[model samples]
Target: MQDLAIWYEGTALAGALRGSGHLYMVVNAAHILGIGLLLGAIIPLDLRLVGIIRSGPIGIVGPFLSRTAGVGLCIALLTGGSLLSVSASEYLRNDAFRWKMALLGLGMLTIAAQHGGGRWRRAVETGVPDPRTRFLAALSLMVWLSVLLSGRWIGFL
Candidate 1:
């Protein structure tokens, strides 16, 4: 991991970012925007799935919100890699960064499990969540919130 970090630090892109504070700031802002988009769409969708915000039909709401959050996830990944490259070695040493990565993997796997489940497909069509769907949704909320908090902890640590 340290070797990988050293290679990342030596990359041309990282060199450019390290040489320019303004560029780093812009990338950081873009990362934040991505986080905002992801959370903004996902939280409401999760709440709806778990029966917290039950006003709208999830059949109508779920797909749109999930796709929007996907876009955000892509953006965040691109910008976050850039941010990490700026100080890869330091980040690798941060326990918070490690936690964020693990939680992120779990969150992604949870999403895959939910989408791959027949219950999820049926719930989307019937506009009602089954037990499995609700459980996955609830788990998604917790995992994503932890990822967000862990990301913040990385900066502090």
Candidate 2:
């Protein structure tokens, strides 16, 4: 892993990204914006799930909102990968970055498990509220938020 990190640190792409230029800043800024979009889409839906919004039909709102959040998450991952490529070695060495990545993986797995479980399908079929679904949503929100915070702290750590 350390050897991989050293190679990434010395790669030509990394050097270009770290060069004295505006492109680097632009990429970094875009990544931050992407993260914001990701969080913006998911957080509110999570709130709704955790009993924060009782007016809407959970069956209708949950899937739609989750799909929107998924789109945002895709954008963030793409942009974040580009940004990480800029300084892969630094990020690979940064403990916060590693933790963030692990959390992200866990979050993704959790989402997959939730979707694959019978609860989502049952709720969609019956048009009924499921507390388990709400719990999954809340957990997803917390994981994503932690991923964001740990990502932000990577630079300093």
1-157: candidate 2 lDDT, tens digit per residue: 7777677667776777778468778777777776776677678766766777666676777678778767777877876776676667678878999999999998898779668869877765665548887788788888998998898798688
Question: What are the Cα lDDT values of the candidates?
Answer: 0.91, 0.77
lDDT of 1 by residue, 45-71 (tens): 999999999898888988899898888
Residue 136, model 2, lDDT:
86
How far off is residue 50 in model 1, in Å? 0.4
Highest-scoring model, TM-score: 1
Best-performing candidate as measured by lDDT: 1
**Against the hidden true structure, what lDDT does model 1 obtain?**
0.91
TM-score each candidate: 0.96, 0.81
lDDT at 101, model 2: 95
